[model samples]
Target chain A: MKCNRTDIDTETRLELEGALDALTAPEIRPIFDKVVTDGRKRVTVDIHKVTMIDSSGIGAIVSLFKRIKAEGGQVLVIGARDQPLAVFKLLKLDRVFGL
Target chain B: MNAETKPSDAGEPTVTHVTFRLRASLAHRSLAIGLVSTLVEHVKSADRDFRNAITTAFGEAFNNVVIHGYRNRTDGMLDVEAELGSDHMTLRLIDDGVQADLSSVTPPDLSTLPEGGLGIFMIHALVDEVVYDSGTRNVLSLTKRT
Candidate 1:
């Protein structure tokens, strides 16, 4: 998976592409940590280009959400469709993230 | 191209079987999933939900073998066999790695927003049956019925 980060004001947007599974989820951990360490209050994850996602991918997003929520920040997940959308719905994260 | 098609009787669906081997690693996960996804698409054709469920479940099962069973060792090899029918699809993943303690797995509390325990839970939720057996090699069978 490829992750690109863009910052505008206090919000950080992360754009992910390709398949986000066990192998590729770890590649984005550093970026997730940076968002937390930098103390960004608003974060957006765009998965429009992600063709597939597994539990590990979900875990990474959940981890980021938890960390951000703990600090009174918000994480917005956008562009979840197809297989990734089904997974989010199955895990009930669509309700939590308002996807 | 280890694919076989069996003749079906009247009013019965033909069964097609395909088997292949893959390197047990995270890098090779997409290939395994793609094969299953293609087979599901071929069999189910227009059912998007069915395709998603099988693809997701198979991906998780493959991840488990590579991450837990193989312990992230690339030296391990996996044999995957898929059976497709009119109303159901089955995938068998065989690996020569440490057997997973299936009894130890429990569903994560979704209310708590847990992260790590969702893989196994999702597999069970998406498929009709999941069976694992271990001896000389471990085999995880996932079947989903339409």
Candidate 2:
């Protein structure tokens, strides 16, 4: 997986590409944690280009959300499509994340 | 990578006994998923929704064989087979790893926003029928009817 990080004002936008399964989720967790913990209060994860995702991927995203919320930071996920989007909806993470 | 395609008595194209190895790593899991997705695409390319369900469920099941079944042992041989019929798809996954106790397998509470334990849940939700055989060999039979 690849992430293009950009700072838009106060929010850190992470545009994610590729699969978000067990294999790729581990690679992105640290990057996501850094983006949220590095003095960034507002964050947006754009998964428009993500082709696939599974339970492990959802776990990584949930972990990121919990960490950000614990630190009093707000996180938003957007632009999810295809198989990854179906997974989010099936698990109702889309509603929880307000994506 | 071994596969065979034939027409059954019903005249529907049946992709039979498409078998592949299940290695003990994430990269191999990804490779297996890619192979399964390609085969599924050949049978259900026009329907993206069904294609996604098959791929996701099969991926989870295959992952279980590596992680829970074999305990990440790379030396063992594990094979998964698939048969694509016109109305449905069936996957027969066989592994020589430890047999799984699936009586307690269920979807975790989604309200809690769990990190793990969602793989089995997703499999049951996506597939039409799933049966696990723990006798002798650990065989996972999954079918999705469209």
Residue B22 local lDDT, model 1: 80
Task: Mark the 10 consecutive residues where model 1 chain A has the least summed lDDT.
Answer: A20-29
Candidate 1 stretches with Cα past 4 Å from truth are B103-105
iRMSD, per candidate, in listed order: 0.5, 0.9
**What digit string (tens of lDDT, one per residue) describes model 2 on residues A1-99?**
998999988888889898888888889998987876687888888888988888888888898888888889877889987898889998998888786
C-alpha lDDT values of all predictions = 0.89, 0.81
Instruction: Write model 1 residue lDDT over A3-98, tens digit each, in one string.
Output: 999999989999999998898999988999999999998999999999999999999999999999999999999999999999999999998888
The CAPRI-style docking tier of model 1 reads: high
Which is the leading candidate under lDDT?
1
Give the C-alpha lDDT of model 1.
Answer: 0.89
User: Which residue pairs collide, candidate 2?
Assistant: none
**Candidate 2 lDDT by residue in tens digits, B1-146:** 78887756585465565777755566777787788777775565327788889889988887787778878577766677887765677878888888885534766888988999898888888888889888888888888877
Write down the RMSD of all candidates, one decimal each: 1.5, 2.2
Scoring each candidate complex against the real one, what DockQ results?
0.93, 0.79
The lowest-lDDT stretch of 10 consecutive residues in candidate 2 chain B is B37-46
